[model samples]
Target: MESKKKEKKALGLAELVAIALGGMVGGGIFTILGVSVSIIGFMTPVAILIGGVFALLAAYSYVKLGVYYKDEGATYSFYKRTYPKIPFLSSMIGWFVIFGYISTIALYAFTFSSYMISGSDLAESIWARKLIAIGVIAVFALINAWSVNGMGKTEDFLVYTKLLILAAIAFIFFQNGTMPVSEFFGKLQVDWEQSHVMSILIVSSLTFVAYEGFQLVINGVNEMSQPEKKIPGAIYIAVFLVILIYVVISFAAMLAIPSEEIIAKKEFSLAAGAGKIIGIWGTRLVIVGAVLATSSAISGTLFGSSRQMAVIAGDGFFPRILARRKNGIPRIGIITMAVTASTLILVGGLELILEFGSVTFLVVSLLMAIANFQIRKQTNSSTILTLLAILCLATGTVLIFYYEYTHQWEQLLFIVFIYVILTVFSWFFSIREKRRLHREEFPK
Candidate 1:
């Protein structure tokens, strides 16, 4: 194994706050709100609140683990430090997630471009999406590669502007929202009683992914200040804020536009919903905000993906070429992630990416919670928290699998393919490292 040593970048609570807020404020709110309102109607707000609660629970689990480990790889490094076998699993999971998020970033960029063109005949061209997406990726890649501070500053800017716009939008609807208490109760009835409840849970689980971005910060645990205190604080704050934002946006859309129209064109639904409420000018404002939000998301994840690869390299599980840090940046890893992301954009798909990541986040969350169980030997508080974390995770997992069974085989296969590749690479790294270590202890 080749070793390349480097210092970890220093980040504080402000940085963590930006990353937490930026991660969740992306395409989901701009896109998912309208569709969710159509499916769940007045109950959309209730569903967002429920999702927020679970996200907060997961955030706390990561906080405990991050504080205890004080390692660069977040859960990957935290679990590795706790048990030797953890690295193999962590590395595979980390790699899988890097690809998943990269794909999502591309998906958002594509969506942004599509919306930009929809309102203007002059902007309409196949090249517009391709050109805009590449530009979005390039701009963020530069921000992330410059330094942690550069990336953090960009994210902080994105977070503030995005929140202000969303808050303004929410307030507008506060004055204009239409679902009264009686009307809400009346519309809450969705055909069959028992079947709708079951269907609601399944669909709601899918919607929950949009709100899981708060947990995205867990990957950068070692990068934050007072991570023990701040990381969890940021997660709780971000989730509550996100859910409230979503609910308000849902209320606004439903008040200003018909839910049925939004449902019919769910893919391009948000722009229409926005235009109806705020006019053509308003739609453009939302699209600009959406682009910035996703650009910030890509910047944060680009940093995270590089860090994950760096951890894998440092562990002697991957080519140490990626382990080298130049001026506080992992250049090779960032480039690799960027190139992979661009190729994913070319592939032009997000369903596969979402399905692949959906199941694995549970695995990561469950493990992080379980870590609380191991460290409990050191402190009973850890045990109690881990128990609570596990309870939430178990329920989320059950809901996820239930959706898997009912949804489609294609979704199931997408997840299975990632697992298979991850297992194969895990073995490849394990065998190569075993040989390298033996040579180090007892020279040729």
Candidate 2:
């Protein structure tokens, strides 16, 4: 009986990779392209590669702590266990990380809605998109609540299919390019010469959110087989593949489409660009690819992050009801995530959600790196790499803030206000936990 139970829980590498990639490739490429291009033009791919470097650095500590702690709570669990004496810090990380996940989910769902309606007469209708986004989130939340195996199989199909479609789109654009690849490189060189280094760096920092989902691999520690091997294998492989996909596809898009069009269309730029280059069929293909990408990402995120929510709840940092599991599914947590993400979709704009998610994840990953550094010997992490992760992540966080402050101070204030709310809630939970402990120790 015990053996059967263990066998049932052993998720293979392919499924794990699907989870990571599904969580990633969803909105990262689709969303970052226009924004990055608007800032650095042809240097978008270079900034993407740099963001990949940030992701790699961040992954170093996540992989280390994930393997060491083996907790489904992931970012929150890593921090809590590493600094067991600081309950407030633990609660705070939990709030930030969960909302960060919520923000990403909102971004994915909104992108999904954008592409879904890109060809329609109502494409410009914000409420229409919000309604579609809410509907998709609810659908995926139900899918996740159904069964883990069901969600994994669905993710495998969506993720692999989207990758094939996306690769084909890139190849098609490459073959039909208006200019030779060499000429494209020549233009990139000239564009780089004309661009500012700080703008490039800031865009790279912004792209950090696109690479945010790689750490979701750690959130599945309990389900996957061989934590020691699969955790690092899935994470590293998925991150590398995503970087390649982003660069190749972005290069292909820039090669074939005009930069002004991509910048103007924003979230639906790929479909719009493809429409101009290859006509309506190309537009449809891009839309299909995007919908699939964001769908898988939404599913993978709801699966992993909801479990993490349950773990945090079990630690008394959230409502106790979230801790309950039925058939190994965190049903309440899953539903809560869907509703909250839907709320964010209704309340936030695309760029606002994007920047907020990038900042939040960068900050959370930086904290994870710090926690890993604190227990490097136990996690068997290299001191140099861990410190590098911290420094790079800190720089990325600051760069985003600087960009927001200089260009959009109102957005910066709203982000800070959200953080203040999260901190207040975290503080309340931590204090309540302390009172409970005191009651136990001192007697009522």
Best by TM-score: 2
Tell me which residue pairs clash in candidate 2.
none
Q: For residues 1-444, what per-residue lDDT tens digits would candidate 2 score against the true structure?
A: 886566457567888999999988887787789989888988999999999999999999989988888888899998899889999999998998898889889888998988898768989999999999999999999988887788888888999999999998998888877877898889799989999988888998988888878888888787777898999999999999999999899999888888888899887788887887789998899999999999999999998899999999998899989999887789999999999999888786656756677788989989999999999999888999999999989988898999999999999988898899999999999999889889999995
lDDT by candidate, in order shown: 0.68, 0.88
Off by over 4 Å in 2: 2-10, 348-350
| Candidate 1 residue 331 C-alpha distance from true site, Å | 1.9
Model 1 spans with C-alpha error above 4 angstroms: 1-10, 34-39, 122-127, 178-181, 189-196, 215-224, 377-385
Q: Please give the range of 10 consecutive residues that has the lowest summed lDDT in model 1.
A: 1-10
lDDT of 1: 0.68
